[model samples]
Target: MSLVFATSNKNKFEEARKIAEGHDLELEHRDVPYVEIQADDVVDVVKPSAQQATELLDSPCFVEDAGLFIEVLNGFPGPYSAYVYKTLQNRGILRLMEGKENRRAEFVSAVGYCEPGYEPRIFKGKVRGTITKESRGSGGFGFDPIFMPDLGEGGTFAEMSTEMKDALSHRGESIEKLVKWYVRNNRADGDRNESDS
Candidate 1:
């Protein structure tokens, strides 16, 4: 089965492709310019984005949105993570945590799947971690330089390989759940049959 991924980021595309391959589905990147709406919650943002992408392409597609929530900041960048990352970067986050002992945070990912004439399905995944005083690693992008997973050593996501990071990443977990839902609901049965033929 083939599904359009509503994103232009090549790294995100590669990761989605890897996950889709594991579920026997083919992921096709669609360069759709989605108007990211400002919403009070993640669900609001994700569902609309998925709907817009599906409507524009007139086909089945999926969109993913993630955010980093800091306990100390009371989720300051909950839905505005991208904006925060762009402006503040890692150094800004580090500065915010300067002299503070409580450095807890979590990465939350929401994956929305939209199909023609069907209601969208949303899947969520979260990974706990702490903000580091200094950025580490150079493997991943975005907040990966300072976002350290709780399970791993005192290194940020940038320090981990793609495989290692995806294996334990919130986005990966969300993708896994989304794939399982698709299979159980037989939403891609037609595509599966076509591929078999």
Candidate 2:
């Protein structure tokens, strides 16, 4: 009932562990960095990362890549969100949005899962919203302070509680799809054990 999550981000590890716990699965962390390949799409990057990590660990494992795509910018940082976040930060995004009414954007996440002898499977999730004029709240990380989800109550992701954000966030949606796929494919360790018994 254990699946290795290929990531070193503590925040990601915590989120993934919470999701796995909800599904009654033991999620183990493999603290290794996979070389991120430059790709046109996040799936392309995540699939290879998952495959590489699984090979290194010789076990079932998963990796995720996410990005912030601004409609106004024609997805300038779609596959380079990490770099953008590190370099520009929320203030930079707000600067980009200043005097621009078309603040439409979305956050996309791709989760790639790989088993020892199986082809990788990808699950995608997205949240649509607009960039706030200024950063709000002190919760969440990265662009959360400026990225406002359409489902939220007039505030940025950083303003929402973890429970509230998870209930309506892009990453949550991706994890839900991942859990569904695992259950459907009998890849969930608990389900596999139950079937074996």
Candidate 3:
């Protein structure tokens, strides 16, 4: 069986698809138009969105929301990262950090899954990093070109290949959690169905 991943972003869907494939799960992308709520954390933003998506599709589905939090800026774009990226973009962020010494930042991703008549389940992941002085590569979307993750070899997220980025990405971590949980639960459900038959 395939699980639906409701998102408008092809890039995000592709990234999550790759992770799901590694665990033998099929992910179907449904570009559902669901409203995201403004909240303190990405988790809060995704939970309702997932519930909305499940209602819209009349099936179990998942949605992911991510944010970029700059330590120096006091998480200026934590839950508002999408609007911030649309309005300010990466250049505006660099300009704000022009004279700052502390380039520390963090990227957080929350994947919320929901089935009909059930509350959404949340899986979260975060990665700490520093903002680059200038935009780097063209591999990733959003603030990727400007964020240098602390886990990798000094390269920004956009500088690395998709495989490399997935290995170190916050989205990857959260999606992995969702996939593992889905796999276990799905198998048990299949067994129950077979027993009933």
Query: What's the TM-score of every candidate structure?
Result: 0.90, 0.90, 0.94
Collision pairs in model 3:
none
**lDDT, residue 60, candidate 1:** 84
What tens-digit string does per-residue lDDT give for candidate 1 at 23-141?
Answer: 89788988899888988577778888988998999988889888899898998778898899889988888898899888899998888888877667788888999888888877888
Local distance difference test, each candidate: 0.81, 0.80, 0.89
Q: What is the C-alpha lDDT profile of model 2 across 128-167, one tens digit per residue?
A: 9988888889997888888889986888889998877777
- Of the candidates shown, which would achieve the greatest lDDT relative to the real structure? 3
Candidate 3: regions farther than 4 A off: 187-197
Model 3 whole-model lDDT (C-alpha atoms):
0.89
Counted clashes in each candidate structure: 2, 0, 0
Total clashes for model 2: 0
Model 1 / residue 183 / CA error / Å: 3.8
Worst 10 residues of 3 by lDDT: 188-197
Candidate 1 Cα deviation (angstroms), residue 110? 0.4
150 in model 3: Cα distance from truth in Å? 0.7
For candidate 2, the lDDT comes to 0.80
lDDT of 1 at 102: 87
